[model samples]
Target chain A: MTSTTCREAMREAIREAMLADDRVFLMGEDVGAYGGCFAVSKGLLDEFGPDRIRDTPLSESAFVGAGIGAAIAGLRPIVEIMTVNFSLLALDQILNNAATLRHMSGGQVGVPLVIRMTTGGGRQLAAQHSHSLEGWYGHIPGITVLVPATVDDFRGMLAPALADPDPVLIFEHALLYNAEGELSAGSIPPIDRAVVRRSGRDVTIVTYGGSLAKCLVAADQLAGRGIDAEVIDLRSLRPLDDATLLDSVARTHRAVVVDEGWRSGSISAEVSARITEHAFFDLDAPVLRVCCAEVPLPYAKHLEDAALPSVERVVAAVDEVVNVRA
Target chain B: MTTVASPVPATLAPSDVELLRRMLLVRRFEERCAELYSASRIRGFLHLYIGEEAVAVGVGAALEDGDNVVATYREHGHALVRGVPAGAVMAEMFGKVEGCSRGRGGSMHLFSVDHRFYGGHGIVAGGLPVALGLALADRMRGVPRVTACFFGEGAVAEGEFHETMNLAALWTVPMLFCCENNLYAMGTALARSESDTDLTVKAASYGMPAWSVDGMDVIAVREATRRAALQARAGGGPVFLELRTYRFRAHSMYDPELYRSKDEVAVWRERDPIDAIARRLTGAALLDADALEALDAAAMEEVDAAVAFADAGTDEPLSDLTRHVYADRRGERGPEEERT
Candidate 1:
């Protein structure tokens, strides 16, 4: 096993994809000499040269649309949007072109483009930069949405996304960039399944992206209080692994969905509805949810911490589902 | 507006009658489409490319094999000139399985990767960046391919148009930005929308060479586009051409013609591209009245056959509604293979 941070894993994935395919190139706001806005592409320009590691103008729509066009032509372009909030500038290209080109063209065109962006609230970046809108992207049809919370996923998800025939949007949680973890040798996880991080039988703590780490902490706290929580890290967000989620919920008979996005119309809401739809009879208690408050993520550290899904919030939700009287 | 008067060389020029026949085909095909829309045989939006036929045919004649074309929703003419079979394009409008985009694109989104026709993009200025990218890919591979993007002057108001121009100019990508300045954008006129009425001026502000041509004149469009394309292929970077023309029909099937004066339409119709070419051909004694009638008859016959083909075409299966959403990754025939 090799230890690495999310930043290193992301950079490594780009390097590997570039080394493998001549068509694969990276383009974004400050991806070259400036070393990327988040420093994920640091040193890639020197390693891959300016052609592969391109630094584009601050025009999001043009760059993103160009990426889609390149993907349509013959190249596999990995476009970094700096952050999920800034991706709104390129939302037209992402929604109208990238997501709809293949189907709209009646299968004639396939945009094998990878759009990586930072998501979630933790740093004091405030409302503009801190919204976890990967759920918004999950609503798209032609695009594959992936949330890589682990070091392995951060390292491995990009290659498959690049290889896929359709466009893929990867939401790398802003707070998890420095989240150091060990990646197993030659053991890359698939992009379509939700894995059981901590298997148990009392409750299924379902979460993805930044909230996975918080839910794991909540699970550890629950175990101390005589409750065994099965933590399921949802790596794939778009085609949600309903079978694994339903199976875990059936075994545990309880679930508490954790999401960093706002509760209403959030991915957490979708997962909760799915469990209720499929595993309604199997549930011993009503499904609970721990999500960020409906208000826009605040700039103050205390308010931002409160507005986001925390370990304490997850623990309380888990406790509520577990200790409920039948 | 500064107009360039470069004579199109005889060797590279298409026969005068051939250009007229191409335009006649588009006119007849779209007229049939209008009739089909009225008869309920064609559903959804139908934007006719009647008056703007010369821009597509002229520009299309200048393009060499393996070149890319990115067009707007009013793309029936562009699709036909780019070599997407009339039958397949008609079938697409009919939403049949045999259509260019397998009937999924309908009227506004005709696509054929085999012909390198990217799409009939619905959004204004959306195809510009895609065209830039196609050129960028070719430029990176050292392939001397020029991507010609067709959009209305209204797209100039969009940020993507400016952004794409800057990028294509900055990167020195081989691209031909063909602006069909057809007076009105849906209902809004160019004077009502753009601060500068001159479309070529907007393109020139990006430091790219730009020109204003008489779009109603097919020879002018062909010559200008040919020169621009040759320059781009010769490492002269991207160039823009504003084809000053007018659409004979309403924006779409549902428009009530509430925008412009009928007199203005009449004035523009006096300079009809088809009539202008037919007059020139007849005046030159190269095309007789019988020959012109024969050409028109041939176009109608082609349109009739296309309609028959569309009528005979089958519908895409209901089960396959979600088929190409992610593209089939299973078989050996993948998206990569299709591009190659």
Candidate 2:
């Protein structure tokens, strides 16, 4: 078993995939020489050579489209958008081409492309640089969206994404890069399902991406107050692990969803919708959400903290869902 | 007959006369298709390829057999030149069971895997990325094939256009981006839309070689496409060629010619590809009036047979409407192990 940070685990997983298959290559701006803004692609240019470790021009659509093209051509291309905010430039390629090609072509062509983008805001990088749109992307059909929370999840999610016969978008949280965990050698964690980070019974805490850690901390806070919380990390965002969410909410009869995306039409909203629809009879309290404030993320640390979901906010949300007074 | 015959192009050599015949076959075929649309024999948005024959004629001839081709909705010319039989293309247009896309794509959408013509993509610039993808495959295989993508000038404004150009240029993949600059994109002309009128400059700005040629001239288009195709297949990387062409008719069957004046349309009609080629042939004494008449007669006969073939084709069964939505796995040996 190797003790690895989320960033190292991710780097090794992609490196392993590239080394294992000639068809697998990484393309992005600053991915080659700069070794990625988060250094997840560090040492890849040296190992894979510049051709495979492609440094794209400041054109996200073209490279993403090219990656889609390569994916359809039989190469398992992994496109790294510097951040989820930058992915809007390539939305046409992702939505119109990559997502629809398989069905449009009558299943003749499968887009086996992996698009990995860093998501969530904590670094005070300002409005344009900081965003979490993975929830919005998850709304689209025909592609899988993975939001890996732990180091193990980071190491385990890449292979299935590369192996899937459809397009997959992995939203790696910027704040989780340094988070470390133990992993058994050759551990291939499943991404198509949710995982329990902590177990509880009084209330269920559901979250993913950068908010999963905050959820776990919130769960610990709930435990001291004699409220048992079940934390479910939604690893895959698109084909959301509905079974896990429904089962947890059904048992606890209470739920709280935390996400860094804006509250309106966020994944939290979708999860809450699903819980209300699926686990309505079992729930004693209304499904609640602790989402990012509806504003472009602020640059200053205090303002930035106010914008995103914090551990205190998660705790407050859980308390609201659990401690109802007459 | 409700169907009209497309004129036979004259610049064609005996070998190219056959090519011109085939191109006219596409023009006439699509014209009949438009008639079918009126008759309710075919449905969906119908985009006819009335003019702009030479661009497809020339570029389609430049590529080797089985080379991947991605085209737009106005793609009858591309399908015809890419070696999809007139019967199949006509059948597809008629929404017959034997159509290239199994009747799933009526008029606007057409796909022929055997011809390697990916399909007639309806979205303006949607085919660009898919075409570049086919090139990616060829490059990876080290095969002597180039993915030739056909698109309109309207697609130039799409963000995907810039994105795909940068990717293809940065990666240096073997792709020939053939821009069919037909002046108008659904009533919006290049003059009214583009900040940069010269589209080749945009391609050149991507750090790749580009060429601009008269698409109405089949010979010139063929020569330029051949040269560009050679550069791409030889691993010289992608080339963007903006073919200055026009549509003799309105954008689609539904359109009214309110944007351009009738005089403007008639003026461009004089420089028609088929007529221009014939004039060039007569000057060289390579083709006479009788030779031109004989070619036109032959084209009419072929087109008649194509219409009959399309008429005879059957429609797809209602049960099969849901058949091709997704691929079914046969459970291949190996790769059963969890990848991650």
Candidate 3:
């Protein structure tokens, strides 16, 4: 096993996939000569050349659609749409073309396309740039959504995603790029099951991507208060691992959802609804949620802090469920 | 202007006559489609490729039997010229199942896998990348197939157009980027939208060989397409051709024609490709008045048969509306099976 940052893990995973399969290639705004905007693909252009590590013009729709096209033509293309917020421009291609091509083509074609986009808010990038729209994406059918929260997961989940016949959206959290952990980058796992980060019996905390770390920190604090919280990191978002979530929630009998998207129509709301419907009989109390405050993320550090879901908020949400209903 | 020795002068008489016949058919099919639209037989967004028939017929003629084609919404001409029956296109307009794409594609989404005609994309500049990929696949497989993607000059504003071209040229994919410069994009004219009205320059910037030709002349479009198609098929990589032309009708059925004047449309009409070809054929004694009438009759017969065939088509059952939403044939396994 080798120690590496989450970003390096991603770079290594992409390099391995490209080396293994000629079909695998990548395209995005600064993916080539300038390396990746986040440095995930720093030395890639030098190794793979421009054909494999393509840098696209400012048009997200074109590159995204091209990726979809390449996938349809049997190339496993990984399209990077800089940020989830900017992905709105390529929504037509992503939703209409990539997501729907296989079904629309009556199975004659499958878009084995992986779109890696940075999601969640924390940086002072404000309204237009900062957004957590993975929930909105999860609503669409014919696509698989995955969020790798750990260095090991960042490296392991790529092969399964690349092997899938349909399109997959890999939401990489902007905050975790620099986070370091032990990782075995050379190997890949095919399982789509959610991994339990910390096992506790009192309450279950379900979350993915940016909110996973916060939930873990909240879990540690809750351990201090003698409130043992079980943490479930949802690796696959679209084909949600409901059995895993329900099994954990059933054991704990209480749950708290942590999502970084704004309150209204966020993934947290959807998770809560799913838990209520599927694991309702086992629940002792209502499903609690810790989501970002409902205003557009602002550029100021303090306001941005207030706009996102924090450990304090997660702890408070746990208290409301464990303290109030305990 | 890197001119190749002017392609041996159009010595092929049958080919020239076929071009005229095909152009006339698209013109008539769309014209009749316009009339039917007034009668409420066709509905939804209808983008007509009336004046731009030469581009479709010309480029489509050079495409080999197995070559792939990806076109835009104004695609009846492209689909029909690519060998999809006009009846199916008309029925698609009427939302009938007999239509190409099983009537799901209508005017903007006609698709026929049998012909390798990918689709009639509704979004502007949407088909470029798909074309690049098609070429890429052919290149990888060592198949001598060419993927021709057709779009309007207005689509140049779309980022995908440039990005796709760059990738195609960079990767040396076998593709022909046919820009049907009909001068207007819906209400937005090319001059108002493009900073440089010359589209070939845009392709040249990406380091691809490009040319601008008279789209108003069927012979010119055919010659340009034949050369580009041959070059792309011969492993010369992607070539960009800007067919300089104008739209005779409004952008779509709903467009009010507020953007350009009737006088402008009339001026371009004087250069009508169909009439030009017919006149040239008559002058050369390759086609007499009788042969010209015969060609018009055949086209009319083809359109008539297509319309009747569409009218006989059945509507897709509501139960199967979700058929192709997920899997092609083997769908995602049930949640339990997916885990395994």
Top candidate by TM-score: 1
lDDT by residue (tens digit), candidate 3, B181-284 = 88878888788998887677778888878888788777777788888878888888899988888888888888889888888889998988888888888888
- Chain A superposition TM-score per model: 0.98, 0.97, 0.96
Residue-by-residue lDDT tens digits, candidate 2, B1-340: 1111122333446566655666666677777777777888777778877779988888888889968888999887788788777777778777776677766665667777677778788888888877877787677679888899999999999876887888788767899989999899889989999998888888888888878888888888887888888889899999988888889888887899799888988888888888777777777677789888887777778768877888899976765554443344335312221111
Error of model 1, residue A211, in angstroms = 1.0
**Tens-digit per-residue lDDT, B1-340, candidate 1:** 5445454544322377899999999999999999999999999999998898889999998999789999999999999999999999999999999999998888999999999999999999998989989999988888999999999999999999999999999999999999999989899998999988977777888999888888998888898888999999988899989888999889999999999989998999898999988887787777889999999999999999999999999988777777778777656544332210
Task: Assess each prediction's global lDDT (C-alpha) against the native.
Answer: 0.90, 0.81, 0.82
True contacts kept of 1: 0.76
- What is the lDDT, from 0 to 100, of the residue A39 in candidate 3? 90
* lDDT-based ranking: 1, 3, 2
Q: List the residue pairs that clash in candidate 1.
A: none
- Order of candidate numbers by DockQ, starting with the best: 1, 3, 2
Shift in Å, residue B238, candidate 1? 0.7
- Give candidate 3's error at residue A193 in angstroms: 4.4
Q: In candidate 2 chain A, what residue range of length 10 has the lowest lDDT sum? A: A100-109
- Models 1 onward score TM values of 0.97, 0.90, 0.87
Ranking by TM-score: 1, 2, 3
TM-score for chain B of each model, two decimals: 0.94, 0.90, 0.93
What candidate 1 gets wrong by more than 4 Å, as runs, is B2-14, B330-340
